[model samples]
Target: MRSKPLLRVRKTGALMVAAVIAFVCAVPLAGAMWQLTPVLLIPVVVFVWAWRAGTDVYADELRVRALVGSTRVPWQRVSELAPDAGGQISALLDNGNVIRLTGVTSDNLPRVLAAGGQQIGHSDQPPS
Candidate 1:
């Protein structure tokens, strides 16, 4: 079967919070007669960060393109799949790298695990 995205989620709350903090930080500088050019980048950075927070897991490849960078793991390289207590699903690779999937829903977790050719375990927590 072709790999498909089981879930897509962004950190909207965190982004908004970051934007607010950036704005607040800029206000003081703006009042001090200082240019707020640097501060303006904060909101943009926050937006980019939020936009990249989404996770994608497919049958043949598991990809995560977050603030750090993007990684594509072929199914054959996946050693195990585990869900943490916080509802984040982690794909453990044969190379010992773990890609955590956030913002996944309970309904989609089953399909993702199945696509990865792994069975869900008792400790597996449904995605949030």
Candidate 2:
């Protein structure tokens, strides 16, 4: 059995609500023609993506899940956690690859670090 995650960060529940609304709106278009029924798949896909895609932080690794696949990054491979100007967080790896952490924002980074038993440090001066 797998151990419980230290943190499971998911997209906002509001996306699920939006997906429902989109599905409801698409019903009319889908009803217009049997051929158009496939239109309904759009919202279903979005709903499933919103429901399944996220980051699960374990003690030994970080599992980043998408609609179709997931990538596992061992903690030792992560060199740094950096946030972009948009406030989305990504992990810079020891080998120089970067992996965006789904649903992790600058605001919640401290919480994530804490859950992973990591420390947070800031530089007083701006980076050159």
Q: Pick the candidate with the highest TM-score.
A: 2
Best-fitting candidate, scored by lDDT: 2
Candidate 1 local lDDT, 12-110, one digit each (tens): 576777777887777778677667567767776776677776667665676777777877778788777677877667778899988776555454677
TM-score of each: 0.61, 0.92
Model 2 clash pairs?
A: none
At residue 87, give the lDDT of candidate 2: 94
Off by over 4 Å in 2: 122-128
lDDT of 2: 0.92
lDDT of 1 at 111: 69
